[model samples]
Target: MRRSRTGRRAGAALALTALTVPLTVAFSTTASATAASSCYAVRGPYQKQAEKFLGLRVDGRQSASDCRAIRAFQTSHGITPNIGYAGPVTWGVMRVVAQQQAAGHQPNRAHKCPTDRGRIACVDLTRQISWVQDGSKLVYGPVPVRTGRNGYETRTGAKRIYWRHLHHVSTLYHVAMPYSQFFDGGQAFHSISGSVWSAPGSHGCVNMRGKDAKKYWSLLKNGDDVYVYGRKPGT
Candidate 1:
């Protein structure tokens, strides 16, 4: 009777293990599924602003969907560490985009850029935008630009393009400054391979996208008027 009782207890233990194994497997599967769907959840400071810009439901909460959307925008715009956080840098670029869209045909509606100058390149440091205007006529752009940083701010006031180099390399920094059109002392309008949206801006040059720079090269020549105005943010 003692041996039979012991065998029954062992069988009961095995039965319990059999039930526990399926539950453990089920929990592991659920955990894997959750992990697969999980995304960075830290709420960014500019969460609401970024959400609104992306046309997402703006509750200011960070969700997996929001993370994916923000990450995609960052990746496309060349914003670094594209982890989906809606930080200031991200929102800053979005603000530029919004301004660009709103600019429409009247980029100079504010009349900050002098219209009297014929075929002038207008650089608005405040908006971080650049365009070419011929006596109130929009000749080209109003595109986003990256100007000089805080200390090495792009000099303001009216100037003239003094020189041009099709394939210029900076002697000071040794970086490529393509389509360089020198307007001020050591400061020029050039194309950078990197994103114009990247912060802290250029050393002194007015950085532009490849296409925009190329267009400027075609339209502008030496002695053309170049007017820079306003103050860059944080400068």
Candidate 2:
């Protein structure tokens, strides 16, 4: 599922500088020479592998070599000194760079954050569907969702959900999904046991704990800031 996400690059911003540690270089890219398309704007196979294997995916039209070049760029930009140089950190940084460039904030980098204001309220990476928070109150959700495996994760920054759920039952609240995926889509998040960060993992969607599922279901109301997003898109 393609995601509309944005945030200040962790290390690219002052966050890392304040800590006196350089940003970690963790991604390499290979873009096709045909165009200057941004990685975030292009989603391809590497994006799939990056998300699945590294908990982060590549965007834009970068080739494997472009991915590698991205790593070199980060290294030159003082991202991090001689480490992996190509991983989730790179994706996170690129998000910042892409948005910043698009917003005309920086020359080639990004500073603006991304969000799904009109996009889907929730997304199921494995299921490839965005969830409706409260089709009635929120005027957006109350839709369907396929959360993570264990039900213990939801990314931060994409959406800020402040509302709570009553009757706290994902299954009862959003009747669009089945019994299996409905395990507890309430507030819990998703993430596979091992790594690979592939489609199998939580993919940065909201996982739910069975116990808290029904509780949140019975508690959430309208106009809540469902602050979502912690992982990157493609993760």
Question: Best candidate, lDDT-wise?
Answer: 1
lDDT of 1 by residue, 85-172 (tens): 8998889888877877788878899899999979999998988899999999999988889999989999999999999999999999
Model 2 segments more than 4 A misplaced: 1-65, 68-129, 133-146, 150-235
On TM-score, the leading prediction is 1
Clashes of each: 0, 83
What does the lDDT read for residue 196 in candidate 2?
Answer: 22
Point out where model 1 deviates above 4 Å.
Answer: 1-39
How good is model 1 by TM-score? 0.82
* Candidate 2: tens digits of C-alpha lDDT, residues 15-46: 65755542222112233332333333343433
Assess candidate 2 and give its lDDT.
0.36
